[model samples]
Target: MQEFTLEELKKYNGKNGNPAYIAVNGKVYDVTNNSHWKNGEHHGYEAGNDLTEPLYNKSPHGDKVLSKIKQVGVIKKD
Candidate 1:
């Protein structure tokens, strides 16, 4: 598996033909083809950012929704 720093993850913003990726609980998932993450965006949440809080607390769908998505990597530890 690959590892990404938050800064490095920012580059894959699902914009300008970039692949969409979001981090949650130290896991990085590919949201490039997820309809909910069209253009790397869902609701007001943008891709290439750590969405742990919103996915765990704010979104009704919850982190369970990520189970269907493909995990590509993990957040790099210092």
Candidate 2:
């Protein structure tokens, strides 16, 4: 898998023609094609962020939705 630093990960915010991606459990997932992640934002949750805490603690749907998405890479320890 590819390795990305926090700064590099910010580039894939699903905006301005960039692909949408979010990190969770140290893994990066491509949400660019996900209906819920359209335009890189979903219910105030934006892509290009480390969503580990929010997804695990706040989301009703949880990180289970990530199973359907592609695992693109891993975030380098900051």
What does candidate 2's lDDT look like per residue over 1-78, in tens digits? 999887898999999999999999999999999988889998898999899999989999887788899999998985
TM-score of candidate 2 relative to the true fold? 0.94
- Candidate 2, after superposition: displacement of residue 66 in Å? 1.5
Task: lDDT for model 2, please.
Answer: 0.91
Report the lDDT tens digits of candidate 1 across residue range 1-78: 999999999998999999999999999999999987788888989999999998888988888888899999999999
Model 2 CA deviation exceeding 4 Å by range? none
The TM-score obtained by model 1 is 0.96
**Over 4 Å off, model 1:** none
- Candidate 1, pairs of clashing residues: none
For all candidates, the clash counts are 0, 0
Worst 10 contiguous positions by lDDT, candidate 2: 60-69
